[model samples]
Target: MFERLISYLDSVRARDPAPRSRWEILLYPGVLALGLHRVAHWLFEARLYFLARFVNHFSRALTAIDIHPGATIGKNFFIDHGFTVIGETAQIGDNVTIYQCVTLGGSNPTNGKGGKRHPTLMDNVIIGSGAQIIGPIVVGERARVGANAVVTEDVPAGATMIGLKARSTLVPAEDWLREFIPYGTPCDDPPCDEQGSPRRDCIEKLEAEITSMREEMALMKAMLAECAAPPTPVRIRKSAAKE
Candidate 1:
């Protein structure tokens, strides 16, 4: 398509940093990516695996993107900036947004068996920049993978993953995108406070407090019981009689 060529040219100009003529400013990276991905995707689907790989390699050399031919990427799949990498056998769902330096690679160390090695991402997932999701895991629909997270397990639907090893943040689907999408507006949701909620530190502190309180209450109860007991009476009657 002529539009695709024009878009690619514009992307080249945009990356150049030099001020281009008025004609180049109209180019859009998203549109250009969509167009190129279509051709590359077609070559992939046609079973021209080698050709598809070549196309992706060439594209990456020029654009810094490396989408494997075996990977199934859906429409409106935006790969922002360069240095984006999607691994072979990674199944990407529709309308997914991926940023630069993201990897959807496999972790099959042995490479003994031949099954689905890469991750299977559900629809509407937004992977933040620099995120690394490895293994044959299923990332559920509408889930958001935060930046620099290293996920190796299944992610439930509508969950938000953050941090090293990627724990679930339990964000709502509506807030997930708003919260974790890189370069977007910072989220105003409840902060993951260190001393609040069910975080590890908070849980440990609460447990310690409960243990201390229990010990204190037990000690107080023992003291009160000892004080409340009637004192043993001496032989007062006998002593009075004797007197």
Candidate 2:
């Protein structure tokens, strides 16, 4: 068990450079939350629902991270800087890293029945701060969900998702294969390029659309100007008698 704890701390250190030592990592709210969650989850599985909830509430108060007791988390799961929420049905895989204020949220079931409502994050998934991963979606392995992204659907493996209503961006091969990225966002000098991939950058797409709209607007204005220009005043030449 001590070995496992050390491994977990090492994993967090691998992702976050701020921690000077294992002791510092241990003091992190996320680390504390996960430790308390283990106790809560064990009680939950033992059918001690009240005790599980009590432990969960205590952890939340102490760490400011709320992880439902029933959530299933795999090995080396790390939450950076806490203030994150994991729903009851959320399933997390090994080596998954989630940043602050992220939510593994669920959908509203019209039938009022609960079953696998939250997200399933595959191994090596990185979710940036404030990302909202809603519904019973699967975030595939090695995928990166960028900060503030709103993801309501399944994410493909090795994809990088960003923006509201999260859209996939073309992740460079190097970034895709990289073991860890600070915030699941590439800091490329120029994020988008001419050679668009399966799903190009959302910002690039929006820029193109804006340019197209401007061109269309210009064309429409020109046509309207031509139409609205006063017709050459009818040369009502003075009648021959009135000259």
**Each prediction's Cα lDDT score?**
0.70, 0.90
C-alpha RMSD of candidate 1: 8.9
Model 1, runs deviating above 4 Å: 1-34, 109-111, 173-188, 191-243
Instruction: Please tell me which predicted candidate would have the highest lDDT against the true structure.
Output: 2
Scored by TM-score, the top model is 2
Candidate 2, residues 1-243, lDDT tens digits: the string is 899988989989988889899999989999999999999999999999999999999999999999999999999999999799999999999999999999999999999899889999999999998999999999999999989999999998988898888988866566588788877865552443333423436779899999999999999999999999998965665786488
Q: Against the hidden reference, what TM-scores do the models get?
A: 0.63, 0.79
- Displacement of residue 27 (Cα, Å) in model 2 is 0.7
- lDDT comparing candidate 2 with the true structure: 0.90
Residue-level lDDT of model 1, residues 1-243, one tens digit each, is 667555545544433354365354334444354556667778888988778777776766667777776678764465667677777788888667776788899876585885788999898787877889998999998788877888999999987777788887776556555523442212443643321324546668899999999999999999999999999987668768988
Clashing pairs in 1: none
Give every collision pair in model 2. Answer: none
